[model samples]
Target: MTSPDEDRRTGAVHAVAAYGLWGMLPLYFVTLAPAGSLEILGCRILFSVVVAAILIRWQHGWGRMRTALRDRRVMLTLAAAAALIFVNWLTYITAATSGHVVETSLGYFINPIVTVLLGVVVLRERLRPLQWAAIGVSALAIVVLVVAYGQVPVIALTLAFSFGLYGLLKRQVSGRVDGLSGLAIETILLIPAAGLLIAVVSSWGQLTLLDHGPVHFALLAFSGIATLVPLLFFAGAAKRLPLAHLGLFQYLAPILQLLTGVLILHEPMPATRWIGFAIVWLAVFMLVADVLIVGRRGRA
Candidate 1:
């Protein structure tokens, strides 16, 4: 058997790799801009279905997939998760490709807080005082953004809430299905709608599928790998590591995304926006500290 320390070390590597890949997703979305967000979303769904199906086959999860398919409640939960993730994908792609990558990063920065709130309100989980303080500080950051920007940070909030809800729903059904099988089922559920939408886009002149030539077509197909591979790394990490460690590493993606936006992408960040982000960062720090403290206390 693998030693616990070795497993944790391996998990940390996988988690970092997963988040690093996710952080670079904005760069990937930039290349797909000609395809339009909806078209890219559709292609992502279709190709992800193919990729996830193959993974499920390799994992010998076909039997589990069939069982999950037969279960009404699990199907319903996955359907909800699928809808939320679709919204997340479309929004992030649109935001990133439209030069709103900074705001997109903000959404992810606030996502953990949103997830914690969902746990409290929807799942009836209790939180420590520091966690509540973190939530309050995060809310203040949102208000600051609204006042400073003269509009609510809708992109960030939408991304945060949609993904938080997606995670919550996935957690609910996590015990029932493995990651590949669940993802395969969810993508399979999306196929009909995605197919119809793609057909409609093709009927219009806007579809970039064949118009962009073979290279673009290849990129569209390769979206399957882009979508599934990081998730596979995350699944591996979750299996090998403690949840607390995994949770801490989740911040890496947003940090890299923020850097990509401000540094590499040349997105403007005014003083006010920077202040709001700083406050949000402080909130995240507090939340993380609380988690660490609580974990230590429990161990003691």
Candidate 2:
């Protein structure tokens, strides 16, 4: 058996790989240019089912999938998860391809705050003082962005809330569902909607999957594997790492995304937007500090 230290090291590696892949997703999505978001989303859903099937068979998880499907509660929860993830994926794909990657990064930056708020509202969990302060700072940051942009940051908010709720729904069925099985069920649930999207996009003549050469078609086909690999890594990490460590690792994705937007994509970030992001970063700092302090006290 591996020692705890070795397990943690392995988990750290997995966590880094997962978040790193997620961070670089904007780059991948951008490369699929000429393929509209709906078309890409549809293909992602359809092909993910194919990939999930192969993985399920490889892992011998057919039994678990059947068990989950038979449980009404599990199926309902996963159905809800499927819808939320559909929204999250669509929003992210649109933003990434439309040069709004910075704003997309902002959405994820505040996701921890949204998750905390959901815990308060949905789980009836109490927050520490720092957590409350962090929320306040995040709120201020939103106000700053609204004033600066002369409108709500709809993309950021939508991505944040959709993903936050998605995470909550996943938690509801986590006990009964393995990551691969859960994803398989969720993707299966989305098949009809995915088909409809493909039909609609094709009608509009915006479906570029076939118009593009074989290279583009191959990339679209590989979307399923791209989606599944990181999730599997995340699952492995979660099983091996402490929650606190996992939570901290979540920041890597947004940070990389922000860098990709500003440094690589040359997305403009004016002073006001920088200030808003700085405020959000401050809030994130408080949350991290709170976690560390509370964890230390627990150890003590």
Question: Which one wins on lDDT?
Answer: 2
Instruction: Report the C-alpha lDDT of model 2 over 1-300, residue by residue, as the tens digit.
Output: 999999999999999999999999999998888898999899999999999999999999999999998999999999999999999999999999999999999999999999999999999999999999999999999999998778999999999999999999999988998889999999999999999999999999888888889999999998898899999999999999999989999999999999999999999999999999999999999999999999899999
The deviation in Å at residue 37 for candidate 1 is 0.6
Worst 10 residues of 1 by lDDT: 29-38
Candidate 2 stretches with Cα past 4 Å from truth are none
For model 1, what is the error of residue 148's alpha carbon versus the real structure, in angstroms, after optimal superposition? 2.6
**Which residue runs does candidate 1 get wrong by more than 4 Å?**
none
C-alpha local distance difference test of each model? 0.91, 0.95
**Cα lDDT of model 1 by residue, 53-162, tens digit:** 88887888889999999999999999999888888988998898899999988999999999999999998999999999999999999999987778998999999999
**Per-candidate RMSD vs. true structure?**
1.1, 0.8
* Steric clashes per prediction: 0, 0
Best by the TM-score measure: 2
